[model samples]
Target chain A: MATTAKSRMLTGSKAMVEAIDQEMERDPRVFVMGEDVGKYGGIFGSTTGLFEKYGPTRILDTPISETAFIGAAIGAAMEGMRPIVELMFVDFFGVCMDQIYNQMAKIHYMSGGHVKVPLVLMTAVGGGYNDAAQHSQTLYATFAHLPGMKVVAPTFPDDLKGMMIAAIREDNPVILMFHKGLQGLGWMDQLDASIGEVPQEPYTVPLGRSRIVREGNDVTIVGIQMMTVHAMKAAEQLKEAGIDAEVIDLRSLVPLDRETILRSVAKTHRLLVVDEDYQSYGMSAEIAATVAEAGLYDLEAPIRRLAIPDVPIPYSDPLENFVLPNAEKIAEAAKALVNM
Target chain B: MATAEIVKEIPVEKARWMYETMVKIRYYEECMVQAYAEGKTPIFNIGAGTVPGEMHLAAGQEPAAVGMMAHLTENDTVTAPHRPHHHAIAKGVNLKRMTAEIFGRQSGLGKGKGGHMHLFDPKVKFACSGIIASGLPPAAGAALAAKMQGKNWVAVAFVGEGGANAGAFHETLNLAALWKLPLIVVVEDNHYGISVPKEASTAVPFNDIRGVAYGMPGFRVKDNDPLEMYRVSAKAVARARQGEGPSLIEIETYRYLGHFQGDPEVYRPKDEEAQLRKKDPIPRMRNWLLEQGLASEEEIAGMEARAHQEVDEAYAYARESAYPQPEEALADLFEPA
Candidate 1:
């Protein structure tokens, strides 16, 4: 039986652990498999008690062979099991890409849409401290290149837990990328899926849809993961400038709900996309281009975007701050847009 | 057929299977040689092709295949190299599909996409790879998966002497040994990889020593002798089934044909092919069967004739079968039903 929870103070990372715990308890098929996830309590401490509580078999400790384990997970997924594999770091995905792109994503399309790989690839992304370029990267853009795959970036605990469950329930292969920078924040421990709210029973959050966390009428803000927090802060600053901004959390990128985005763009007639990844070929660029193609004529002004410069994320705090998009940067971009 | 009926006639049945397999491979290669000379298949210019100037055959390695694969179960997996005839025939790949694959027909495995070196028959657990040691890790993964699922299955990877000399083989073996994975490395030691002799490629005096490097039991068998190969491979296969870890069984074989079907034998001496032919395992097994009163000369000849006729018919069938259609090319590219 799942351990039911009400109000409790938990970090975002801890919230993810509790969510996975409750998920494993709710469904017998749901299991966690990854390297050192069993004995090490996760490199981020997200899964502290899980290994001892669930045993090593269900919470498998794999070899450093990412390709092998990923392929094994594909086979396991094909055989009717929901496997959530934790790639120690997002960069390690390069080693097991064949299983991710060729086998998992293409399984349904390749099998003539016969099989569904219900796999959740959870990996830690983004650079905050000195982990270097390899360990910390927003490589969700890499996944977005492929078809038949979903990319979910959750910023809050409740949304994180909900989106994680929704990703597991998805019939296609889904990549749930976690930014290392947004490790601990806040979320509802228990979520109700049926009514898009806290239910009397277990439930999940909807995918492919945007959440309007903060609403306005003057302009629309497309917030990507950590950018949402920055966007909210930017909105508070923009309020003083008499510019109201509607902030949208783009939960799932691939099956992006264009209706919601176009509706916001229609209401505001101006869009400002904020992302932490590199500006070139980044999510900001993708969203800006998508809006132009979909609602080009409806726009009163050209779309503006705020993102990290197209360079290796710097090591020093001074350099890194300039490299990544922050609240100040978002405010500056939004202020510039409103002034125009 | 049940194990009892199968084992009762194991010797005779295995020999017959060996003879028929040899005939299938021989005739298939002969057909490709003719087709290659006729310019029916295209030249890849660099890598991959069964067409003229791009193919490889196992003319003398038939015994190595029949001997080893004779010990396999349908549930077990087989990892093969580019020169994959022996494994292809041994794994029960349809003669028609096999020839079509060599012919670069749309009817081939991978639907003419992978062609010769890259055959993937999920129904029979045959995973072919052009990369020398590429198949080892996957086979090791398959074995681990089998063990995890608690299934009585084994995985065999057919590596060449050159690949057995590579690091992938060693790494895969170490991991398989550590996990006690139900896998076996069947090193088909044909002495030469393409043009380079085994000595120039490896420091280990013999390829069989490469087996012990993985901490698993190793064996060297007369690859030209089908029965001996069968005995060695059967023991290993059974041990793997019984939860024993991997084994390295090196079959000291020879390639009667060139490295590839249309390849010139300029690197080796002219009489080498003839010398290897003298140890033809099919006829050797036939002679052993006759002297032991297991089968008559007429029976063996008749079986060979039947085998030849079957191959001829399968080729004709493949030739007459419709080309897989342009639209169908994209189908089954991934895992389409």
Candidate 2:
């Protein structure tokens, strides 16, 4: 809504760091801690120019100890310090899940409201540039399945900044997952939509909310994180093919905005859920279930889902792209549903 | 390098407290072994029991916990590994709540949310993780918090010798040393990590010497002697309290039980456990206490009886407590906004 002709356009990475910087300046208790988050400015550029401004006390370049640093973030948060800890990649959660899920997620609940952990766990997700099974994964569904943690993924620069500020200010632990493909990094093929006009002042887009990026009535196409970008493109393609599609970006997964999704299905009477995470028991399924339970009478056709199959994301570009949801896949799925 | 002499004498009251705590931990673990066996008599179904999960009993590792914890106060913090009962008991965690948690009762420490391996008692600043070597960083973080807040409070992390090889262990040591955090890393070298011996898993023979690589003084307690552990930890605790950074201490301890309650322990030699039992730290400390004139036999017997009574009361409390409601599973997942 702040976008204007004179507004400055920023990349997703710069917008994320700008939000963190503004918040750090606002609150002395806030700090950054993670591997390569200092001098390297984060492997994905999430913390660029922060270390030089904040110094070592604020911008801590930690060793490659995901378990220790992340766990330490939880400890610091419990002590009333707001720490923005990075896990480098979402695929590496396996090494430090105890600290993330068992400790960070459960400490507030385990303490029975006596202890409150206010921290933002930022991590890079998704893969398109042949990083293989280990480096490339968007395990958003895995974190959402577990209780006690708020999970969010932003598509554009503005939402990334607002949601990040909102995450840093939240009382509970929040996992801010950013996709690599949408980060606008120089090495990877970036999306033009990933760069957007961001407000200079710090703002917070509330969590647990969904945004209607494109509105139509023929079919409802819901996407999460990076898939939202693809859905917007697919909506354009569907228009050219004589079909009107509605695109919804689900920013938060834990407190899923089921009402917005149900309303879209009601108007469209057809549904297509797109996700970059695994197919089974993921966001796609959850969206389908949401529509089936509350908006079953509104649908004229069965909900179709486009996502990665239940297999390790291969290193080959063709294999990886084959499984990943894209504009073509979303457009195809929406056309099929509309025809039905 | 010269070895530090064990010249500092532990006070009579402190020695007695350690003895009683060690006795209490031994009895509690012994009781757990029995409690874990209930309802699984005909066939060993791990999921079908009063304590329905894998139970790791720290029966022979009491000295490592009591020695280090004796130097800590309630304000200090402790993060422990999967085998954490001795550490929790030594750190003054409430007995009734811990037992109820192990029994998955509603009155438990975590309200039956965290079981034996995942016990967390913030009142005494005690927490443990089921993952190996996972608690080290949090301990360092707590120490960092203490330093940042200008508190003299120190934090201790307990891990197994096998866990010493984990990346979390090394990373935390570096962080603690670099930041000058009041942290002490204690490794209970129980000779075996589950089924694999230390030789097979660890690159070095002693984890203590690895501290030198991280610019911290490391000491190895040769035998599982409570007095020796106390002597080594005294220096580390004093150093940490003095703002002299972290220290690593590895105590050569013994594990009497299998890795878990149901572990067959096929990899262990038949006579290995029996050999380790001959040098049990409990009786060794009892004899040392009597020889040093720190406690009388009557006092020792009284302490042992008191420990048994406490364990009995805790078990009763756990058994009498009720299970949480079935729908309560959805509760506690998130804090109410």
Candidate 3:
């Protein structure tokens, strides 16, 4: 919990900006463009001090045009510019999906490898602030379901910094979705696990790799982004109940870390996939299918998934909390899986 | 700035092609209405038809599609909204394959992966989305691609007047103007966004005026006249091809059918459809072509028969084609590595 000389404690947003800054300084082609990315320094603080450092040319402030700018990012990328465009909210993918899915995601393949779109589409995701249905969604499955793009959600500052650098460096389009609750913002509820010691130097966390945050012999609890933070908390709660729960952070969804998941499920007889995305046809179902496909015999108990029921995230505090996956709900599901 | 005299400037061959395209689009929609009603006769169960799901036929909006598409080449890109059959036909999408896709057959455009609303024909550089106003940004991207590659090819996005209220519309307009991309946004003002009239949903009477705020020229084509559409879109297309930037054109179009097949007419006025039918663009265009001495009555009748035959063959092809294998639904989500 304490910061040492080798590493300093950074919030998820600061770590993300640090990686972007380092990348911009390193590559002249690398730049940031989005709504409020300049002067305002990103409403979520993802681009905080970079605007002062990079100025208007590099850190361009766009006119809230997710489709045009995002599409322009694809055009620029095709023309040999590595643009790091931000979609203010993952929920806003609705307005610009044709650009995201049809253009950005498929242009490379559609062009038969003749073109490469190496743009990083970073966006704020997750629900907990009572922002309601329109604003609050972690639609990981929506992007992951489409084949062309890579989807990553990093919870801690270390992985946030490292994976962001990796996403920027990757040749394909990478969707870097960060959880709002995990960003360590002053206005929203913060997660302690989101604040961690991150090295100042640039590093790359390989995409498609899953990390086992906690090792246990009894049950496997799989999560991504904010759910990983919840899963870790649930692990602690289960530990007190004498249930050893293994927590796996699935940083990337498209090139899913199925091997780590299968390996973990093979070790622990029970599996519980927790997600903040919709329950049906989402991350939970995909993870469940992965285990069922190859690691079915390893499960001693039926695989359980805890996710938001197929409903829009509501506005009121009680309603939003009721639908979202928290430590309590995750602990309950893990406990039930262990008992079963 | 296209006046009535500009309508005369349209080449006779182009005018004839536009009329034939409108006729073909109307016949296609009419055939689809019958095809969609096949199994749902007495009970009217929406899920019972061969075309199973919701069907939104663009019967009365042919002029807008042919007007803007008349300027486009095979290399130019088009991104259309959900009610896209008219645009698809006018843009030269293969009718049989598109119909087969609509019928959920294996040989369809997306190989049955994408149904009616999600048709993607890369050969002609045409794609459409089911979501409203979502196509504008991608169309801009296509235009941006052309500009960056130093090509004269422009991209056109066809959206409903209802879609103009979406943030994507404003965003795309501003972005396209700022970047000086060769893009055209055509708003087919069909008066209703699924029963909510434009007055209730839009702050402005006309969406074209919004283009002025975005620093682009905006034009409105009155009364769904195909010739007028051709005239106004000609200027817009010329400006875009010259790298002058994007333009917005709003066509006062009409939707003759319900928003979707099987949608009860509870929200519509009793006499609206009948009144709209009185000024059907297809018949009006036919009369205009005859009066202009551009085509003989026999030529117009021949065009009508040919259009009907094309629709007939497409429907038959769709009916005879095999549905995609159930397991094959999992394919085409991503291209192969």
Candidate 4:
């Protein structure tokens, strides 16, 4: 876009790693820690070379004692340090929920809001990695349900860089989730480790802004993380049939851009939300219920949602295909909502 | 920090002071129990328990408080477990205000919000906690802060025998050992954690062995004599103040009163409680002091009477203090998030 000649591709996680590495070189307090974060370059290699650059104290290699290390991070943050703690997988947040929900979120409020713990808890969430039931679950619903925390999941590489840098700078505690299945979906990563196409320098995209990736008016389709990729593909399919549909990427959940969603819905008049998590009472319901409560008269038709049914996300090709909402399901749902 | 011995035995004046303090604690607790039966206090105790008559191990645990605090300079921090009243007195947390705190008066440490075990006087380095084993890492954090700021200060954490089983205790010890933090962990093993025996709670025979596992030098002092706890704690204080990291002093003592005011004597065996009482550090150390001509019986008696008088005055002061205004309950509720 900036008249670049050598634009390339990269994975979202790899982009995050490069951004963190470059930031670590620039700043002193920005360091990473977790199981195998150092030496092992992180479990999924999300933190490669972080340990080598910073020694054990700065780039600590903690034991599997999540509660202790997380508590230690809280203390460290209070005592002036910006630690980027990796949860390995986000589902394990349940293990140290007390430190996350009780301490990290409430410390500032309890200290009469005198304390500011600038910390980032980065983790991989979502299913389809065959991470089984425990590791594959998406608990953003639990985090977003709470008031004090902010949640961000980026679908593209440039977005990851922007969100992460913002998360690091944010005075409040932020949870930046990278779904395991959407690692390299965008051309932000190349087969080689270089971030050739990503914006050369670091920058921040303000939280709670929805990027309207495609312009249309017939139906408004909302997608999150990996689901956004599918929603765009489905919008392309809808265009061939002359059914113009708007594709909105809901980038964040906590500081959710509801005003943006309402603006799109006012023009489109129909809403179709596609989520990879379970369909029952998930993000889809949250959005649908809020829209209904806020602008019941703005809707020309009932909102439609595409999500995995109220069941464990299946791993088999056919079963997973049947349960999960994809481009085909998004198009079908959008067609039904527009037709209504 | 150097682990050198205190270099001299307990002098006569200090022995009398220690004996009188212990006696005062014992008598004051017994008096509070009597007052409770006479309708002096309400049921809403500060530490999620009863009022008055609720003291535990105050008789045997004084020397650890006195000795551990003697070495601290102005900038050091100290965190205490539930039975923290002794530490409060030893560290100069205004006895009248502390007494007011325990009685749930408006002039209390947390302005009546936190009571008994929750004393929080930030002006002094003294803070209190009711959650068992919750104070370790923060204490280590203070020591880390002292190190970072280039100050010659240390932090001390005191807990009971059973608290060593908590993950907080173990992790703090490991981290202190790893960083060689200037801290002293005084394990006031008064034979029991509330009503559960230490043997029932821990697989390890003694807390000293557990301390050894964390790679710190441990002292299993048979502090059946209060003077011995003072002597051992002096060495620990020296080591910590000199920046030699933490040392664990397991003072094997006993509690004479019931766990709390209302707890019946059903859990403790009759003979077991009697055996522990016989080994109570107060009288044993008293007789030792008298035998060694360190304190005359009159001197010890006078100290005991003075401690009781002090307690009586504290009770009077706490009673006269006005109740906190209703709106004060919501005050200091949030710092600002």
Candidate 5:
């Protein structure tokens, strides 16, 4: 007789770890390498319990040399071994951007399709934890701007589990940006969406698909990662005010689901793109441009963007809160778009 | 011009192969220079004809390549720098395909996407990059894969003296040592990085000595003798294969040509190239082979003839090969459906 274990709620970080564990169990070629990923169980606990389960051979703890380890992942991937390389923080891309952009991103293309780099580069992004400019910036837009890489930022626990598994199985190089605010760590504040029921079996929430988390007819609000949580809250507030709002969670940035966005905008007739990354030339602007270029005729008002106002994330809570795109700011932007 | 000491331990068969491989690299470079000149002369333009683009000739570093490459099989991986043709040839990359790649033909290693600087032959596990010091980290990765997969293969990174000072070099060496990865770091100390000399760029007098900081053995072999290079490289390769971790081997050599095809070369003294040519590895190896009774003069001549004929055939094949279609440019950016 088959025994069915009762499903329990898992935090986003736990779900992520479970997903990687399942993939590693399924494929022998899959392995993990990064700083503090072995004994410390990842700074964010995204790799918790992986080291004991997989051993040192698979769960490797690397030195603080991002360039070497990341490049090694690229090489291992090119040799047909799937590697999951983690950058401690998205803000640390400066040390190894060449390996990420030049080697990992362009090698397959530069090799004239002779090679394939199937690797997942996971990193912690966003700032609500009083970490200064260097540690707390959502730089997924910079990665998304680059071609040859698929950038994903999932907020919900289930989506995090699904995307992490999908990224590992992808043939193309993937950058998985996990928002710190959504990780549900005991040390940091958590979101309700972080603790949700995740399926025990392996599954993939296909990339390039935007989920309409909340449906309404007045306006469309788009958010990714941490901003998605704020957008959901903003929608709830807007509903209390009787102004029905729709929210979109953009899971993948490169293979963008512009159809879902445009379709939502065509029905709602308003757009408010919410992003935790910088405002200028970022995901916000990209969404605004996409809608303006393709779905302009369907819009009722000018597209509004609520994002970090092009400044470094400060350590002070008040300063960070002022610049960050929270529910109040997103709700305000949505109300302005509806008023316009 | 006989040296006092000769390495007699190398088998006669292995000695002959080394001599032939050196001859092959020399002939390939000779043919490349002529082909490069044909496109350069008659008004010396950058993108003139046939074999276009500026070339970084690897004419004098054959000893370092041949010595280390002698112990390597097709399963072994090598990451090379801009001046990479010598290492690629030594690693047994298809001569015809490499020639076609230089000619920008569809039958090339990268199907003409990668030029001479970025040659890659997956079958032979040969890869290169144009960026300085960029190859070391990838070679570490290749070694990491070999270790993780329980394979006996090792990855050799061919860097220059100047590249040893790079963050990529130090970081990769440290990681390789820490992980006990099977990586052989070869710094071909040709004493020049384009116009700048090694002394001006690097703090250390020797590159191999830096390996001490990473907990790996370091050795320097002076003069470009194939046998000496082979002996030192053999120990390093054996240490790596036995899971003893990485080693840095610096080969003292010189470059006969300028860094690139059209380089004005105002940095070096006028007699420097002529002086370095006196100790050229190719002629020295040939003389050593004769003195050691490894091969007859006629046999040496026959090896040279075969090298010349092979390069000539490769050039002809490249010349007759078709250029990739314009739409083909958009094809290789992603995998085929």
Candidate 6:
């Protein structure tokens, strides 16, 4: 929310495009290839202006062949090319799960350090505009369950730009899941924190890092991607009631910043994990398990996780809203934790 | 147009090299089969903890492997199917390392992680997939990189006739041709996919002709002959290298053994294997070598002995090599953060 003259105000999608543009300009081997990435400028606007800037060779548009294109990205990466490929939606992973999980994810590790797959698989995630079950999944946990790649979800423009650059420069495969609500698309409802001042100069936000957006002493609320925005809002409301709520935005999931989470929980001694992914065996469960295993003594109350119940995301707006965790739900969970 | 009788003049040196490669592949597979059987005593179990997993031996498919591989260079890449040993050897993968990998040793191509069906050798730009026709997409990817980088290198994908019926195969071929990528898709028609006959599984009479739907030239090299296989493969490879886009070349070959080490092969008609053995590419190639005066009887025997010796040495090395430690299984899941 900083309005200083020195910083450039950019939307999350624009920042992502700039990060990719900078990386592609720096390394000739780095290129973007995926469906609708060229003429359409990316359906989510994440690749806006990249086609006109880089031309056809670098900003290649592909057919709707996920198995072929994603598999091709793996082959190209094996041949010393740094390719940034976008899967249109994380929900569509079912069509080409073998290519992503078996080949792209397992190749580097199976090669016994002899080979490296420096590829970035970017996909759109989350649901709030009634995009339905197919288009509205935050399935980064599904990817993180497999042991090969890094999964990142950024809640703000600055974090998106920095993470995009870092993911492109990384030698291992990284999955960058952008929540639809945080893209600052004008047609869609935009969160105030989605658009912010970003550094014009290209930089990398280190992977496996967490940001404490709000610090407090009473409780620690862990969130990622769209859920982080709701948690921060809940914190603002809790402040009026004199209940101190700490909010943490988990930027990366694979090499999870457990130390930061543990440190915050040690101080607050009350935890509420919020995730857009489903409840059972998900990011929420993993975070809760981490706290219970390592920071058991610091817990002043039982850990609470507000996540989607085990059900497919529905297309109906009210039904979808009922399933998704929101600021109200998060604040209620926090109040319970504080009261306990 | 009538099927013109295509006559291709072969150089003596090239013919000699092809013969040598075919012999080497035959000997290597024979050794692996024997080694695999040695661990399976009177029981004859597929999973008796010797070679451990299913081994799909490519005994009678030498012509397709050597012929298509002869046009490849170190810079060029290839993706192979479940039956990949012949392709691996023909593609210039280190034999010692490949054998050790088959034995699950620590010094193998994937350090014992990938085993035989999933071998990946960066030196030779070789990779394989256990899934049917899954190799086509990755091969197209390598070709994509070559086209983007403006390199003359080509990538080859090897799939069986049954695999050619897969959706991925058709999709990849279409993409390669549409993008004008430097790729050659070789369909080795081996008559059977495990227990299912190619006739029952494949819709098209000729898998190569399926390329017409994708606007690419298609050719079928018939009769189990390596020289003919080479002529067709060289043309397809040249088409890819010249930026004429991808081509489909199907080589009619056969696998000498069952689908896997322990497959009963009840689906096949009686004595079908024995009948197909009559058209084995190895002896046919040997006869051509003698008729063309490319090698004397004594020199040919010497070459065969050398191949056997090479395979014997590889077998010994694999036997002596130590297996990867159990704790090492936890490693290589990802690059250290």
DockQ each candidate and list the results.
Answer: 0.21, 0.43, 0.15, 0.18, 0.64, 0.63
Q: DockQ winner among the candidates?
A: 5
How well is each residue in A2-47 modelled by candidate 3, as lDDT tens digits? 2343678999998999999999999887888899999999989999
Best by TM-score: 6
Clashes of each: 8, 0, 0, 15, 0, 0
Per-residue lDDT for A222-255 in model 2, tens only?
A: 9977788889989999999999999999999978
Cα lDDT of model 4 by residue, B1-337, tens digit:
3345563666566666666666666665665566445543465453443244344436546667766655555467777877787777666666677667666677766666666766655556676566676666656656665655555677778888888888778877887777677777878887677878888998988887776787888876675555566667777666766677878777676666666656677877878767776667776777887799887889777777798898888778877887678787665533323
Span of ten consecutive residues with least summed lDDT in model 3 chain B: B1-10
Q: Lowest-scoring 10 consecutive residues by lDDT in candidate 6 chain A?
A: A1-10
TM-score, A chain, model 4? 0.91
lDDT of 5 at A57: 94
lDDT of 2 at A293: 91
CA lDDT for candidate 3: 0.86
TM-score of 1: 0.81
Candidate that beats the other on TM-score, 1 or 6, i.e. the better one = 6
Off by over 4 Å in 2: A1-10, A106-116, A127-136, A181-192, A240-242, A278-281, A309-324, B1-7, B42-44, B262-275
Model 5 spans with C-alpha error above 4 angstroms: A1-7, B1-8, B38-48
Off by over 4 Å in 3: A1-32, A38-60, A65-84, A89-120, A124-150, A155-174, A178-206, A212-247, A268-340, B1-8, B199-204, B264-275, B290-293, B296-306
Give per-residue CA lDDT, model 6, range B98-168, as digits (tens).
88888889988888898889888889999888888888888998999998888889999999988988778
Docking class of 6: medium
Interface RMSD of each: 5.2, 1.9, 4.9, 4.5, 1.3, 1.4
Q: On residues A1-340, what C-alpha lDDT tens digit does candidate 6 reach at each position? A: 2334256889999999999999988999999988899988998998999999999989989888888888888888888899999999899999888888888888876676777888999999999889898889998689889888889888899999999998998888999999888888988896787798898878888988999999999999999988999999999889988989999999899889999999999999999999998999999899999999999999999999999898999999799999999999999999999998
Question: Which predicted model would earn the best lDDT?
Answer: 2
Q: For all the candidates, what are their Cα RMSDs to the real structure?
A: 5.3, 3.6, 6.8, 6.0, 3.4, 2.9
Sorted on lDDT, highest at the top, how do the candidates line up? Answer: 2, 5, 6, 3, 1, 4
Relative to the true structure, candidate 5 reaches a TM of 0.95
For residues A1-340, could you state the per-residue lDDT of candidate 5 as single tens digits? 0125345689999999999999999999999999999989999998999999989999999999999999999888878899999999999999999889988888777677788889999999989889989999988789988877888888888889989998998888999988887888998885787898887877888867888888999999998878888888999999887889988999889789999999999999999998888899998899999999999999989999888888889889899889888898888888888877
Give me the displacement of residue A265 in model 5, in angstroms.
Answer: 2.0
